[model samples]
Target chain A: AQSVTQLDSQVPVFEEAPVELRCNYSSSVSVYLFWYVQYPNQGLQLLLKYLSGSTLVKGINGFEAEFNKSQTSFHLRKPSVHISDTAEYFCAVSPRGSNYKLTFGKGTLLTVNP
Target chain B: NAGVTQTPKFRILKIGQSMTLQCAQDMNHNYMYWYRQDPGMGLKLIYYSVGAGITDKGEVPNGYNVSRSTTEDFPLRLELAAPSQTSVYFCASSYSLDPDREDTDTQYFGPGTRLTVL
Candidate 1:
């Protein structure tokens, strides 16, 4: 079984400030990592994913994540956040050699304050 | 394409009531899923179907039932609704199961239906 842990329950940042949301995972085998963003009262939208290849992956709305294999982490980063970036972010992991059944972290609410 | 679509944007149910959450996809996706999101918690899979006539329980499937009568439709049924079942439900679909097909596994989600049981 796989599980995800988001280090922070909430992150408040000022507009134009850089931000990072930490995520860690535990799994017996290799896994695929994903970041999803959910706006208020809406379903989740895929922000980015790390299946293979480069450790640094860029996503929509100027969001990016670095997959650290040694640390078992996939932390999301944005150089400059905006008010529109306020949302809940979730990290998910799926088994390496199976159907895509995701195990998600609790989530971290990103509040971009002016 | 309309992608994945779920009906009933919001609903309220009394204890012991029953209801079905309808889901349909126009993307010809073979894999459909039902997930519920609670406050502060991420989505938990309730049920899933790999194709028509094939349904399976997910991580949190208790008090829930599902049917995949057609490739385009997958409905989730709630029997004897409880307050614990009140949450936002989302329907998602993916094209295939191949791990190498990561692009295809990127699920498309619906608008979601918020249910409150009192």
Candidate 2:
């Protein structure tokens, strides 16, 4: 079994400022991590994912995340934020192999204020 | 390709009513899933299908049913709808994971269906 925990429920940041969304997971076996973004009134979109190798992974919309096994965290970061970057972000995890059940965190609303 | 499509973008059903949420994908993916997202909460899987003629339950399968008769369509049925079922429903599809490849398995989603049970 696996579960995801997103540290923040809401994150407010000014335009052009850096931002980070923290996510952690717990599982007995190796797991795959993913970050998804949801715009208003839309479905979730894949921003990035970490399967193996390269603890640091980059994703669409100029976003990136680092996977820290020891800390059991996959934190998403953006160097600079744009007003368009404001959206709900979700962190999800699924077990290795053919398992397709993804456990997701509650979510974090990233409000980029201009 | 249409990617993923869900009908009835919005709906309002009275308690104990029944309805079906339609989801279709043109990507020819082998895996399809149903998930519901409550306000401020993450999405929870309701049901999933590995392929045509095979279905399975997920984290939150109660009060929901699904069927996969074709590769392109997987519909979710809500029996005796309740207020608790009022949420945004999303249908997603993804290619099966490959053990040999380290690339992360990604799921593509539909626009979503917003349901309100009054």
Candidate 3:
């Protein structure tokens, strides 16, 4: 079984400021990682994923994440944020042997204020 | 392409009532999943189907049942609705189950259905 843990429950940042959402996972074998964003009253949308290759993965909306194998962390970062970027972000993981079925973190709320 | 569609955007059920959430996808994906999002919680997989006539339980499968009779449709049934079942339900589809598939880790989600049990 695989599990994800989002360290922060909420993060508030001023518009145009950088933000980072921390995520950690627990897995005994290889894993796939992903980040998803959800707007109010809407479904989730893929932000990015790290399967293999480059440790730095870029995503939509000027977001990016780095996969640190030693730490078992895949934290999402945005150089600059906008009001529209305020939403709930989720980190998920799936074990190598299992199907694409994912295990998601509790979620972090990013509130970008003007 | 109407990637994924879920019917009854909002629903309210009384205690002990039963209902089924309908889901359909047009992407011709072979893998379909049902997930629930609670307040302040990320989506939790309720059930998943690799293909027609095949289904498996997920992390939170209690009080819920699912059936995938065809590749295009997968429905989740909630029996004896309870307050714990109140949450936003989302349907997602992917092209394959193989972790390394070309479209792996890419899941298209539906608009979501808000269900409240009182």
Query: Individual DockQ of the candidates?
Result: 0.65, 0.71, 0.63
lDDT of 2 by residue, B1-118 (tens): 9889999899999999999999999987889999999987789899999999999999899999999999999999999999999999999988775655333267889999999999
Cα shift from native, residue B81, model 2 (Å): 1.6
**In candidate 2, what are the lDDT values of residues A1-114, reduced to their tens digit?**
888999999999999999999999999989888999999999998899887789999999999999998999999999999999999999999886544678899999999998
Model 3's alpha-carbon lDDT is 0.91
B4-93 per-residue lDDT for model 1 (tens digits): 889999999999999999999998889899999888778899999999999999989999999999999999999999999999999998
DockQ of 2: 0.71
Model 1 misplacement above 4 A: A97-99, B97-102
Q: Say which candidate scores most in DockQ.
A: 2
TM-score of 1: 0.96
Which tens-of-lDDT digit does each residue in A12-112 have in candidate 1?
Answer: 99999999999999999988899999998888899998877899999999999999989999999999999999999999998764544878899999999
